[model samples]
Target: MSSNRKTLWQIFRAPLLLGLLSLTGLIGALVGDGLFDLISWATLGSALAVIAWYWAKPTV
Candidate 1:
């Protein structure tokens, strides 16, 4: 496999994306709308995907 280098932001993208999505979901939840529920579920699923990606990554 080729050596791929990741910058600091790239390495930290998942939690950052999760945080932004969660914040958006929270704000939507506060507004009380069906759209927010979808956003929340999407955020949750994205979180799970991120977790799975890291869990299944190859170890050096």
Candidate 2:
């Protein structure tokens, strides 16, 4: 991979990957007619919040 692409992936990889996984699970749950909307939302929301927090204040 190009350095620029690698750098971009390094910056966004975790959140993007986790978010995609969460979205997939959320869609699966919804399509399966599961009554776990709140749980899914909370899980995804918390993941997003953590990602935002880390982006805002990254500590080495």
Candidate 3:
């Protein structure tokens, strides 16, 4: 039998990064207009894409 071990950082890194990006998007939406608004939309869209991708995955 083989067992693979994962570290805390490995597990949390993606979620933390997504959280940071989403937070930045929220702040950008609040802090400015024009380019910042566009950036915020793009970042939020990327986050939603990731969520949809994960949600569509097959589970066993």
Residue pairs clashing, model 3: none
lDDT of 3 by residue, 1-60 (tens): 236887899789998998888988999989999999998998878899998998998865
- Reference-based lDDT, each prediction: 0.79, 0.72, 0.88
Cα error, candidate 1, residue 22 (Å): 1.5
RMSD of 2: 5.2
Write model 1 residue lDDT over 1-60, tens digit each, in one string. Answer: 458998899878877889898787667767777887788778767877878988999877
Instruction: Give the best candidate by TM-score.
Output: 3
Candidate 3 positional error at 53, Å? 1.1
| TM-score to true structure, per model | 0.58, 0.43, 0.81
Q: Report model 1's TM-score to 2 decimal places.
A: 0.58
List the candidate 3 regions with Cα displacement exceeding 4 Å. Answer: 1-3, 58-60
Residue pairs whose backbone atoms clash in candidate 1: none
- Top candidate on lDDT is 3
Shift in Å, residue 53, candidate 2: 13
Q: Least accurate stretch of 10 residues (summed lDDT) in model 2?
A: 1-10
Deviating ranges (above 4 Å) for candidate 1: 1-7
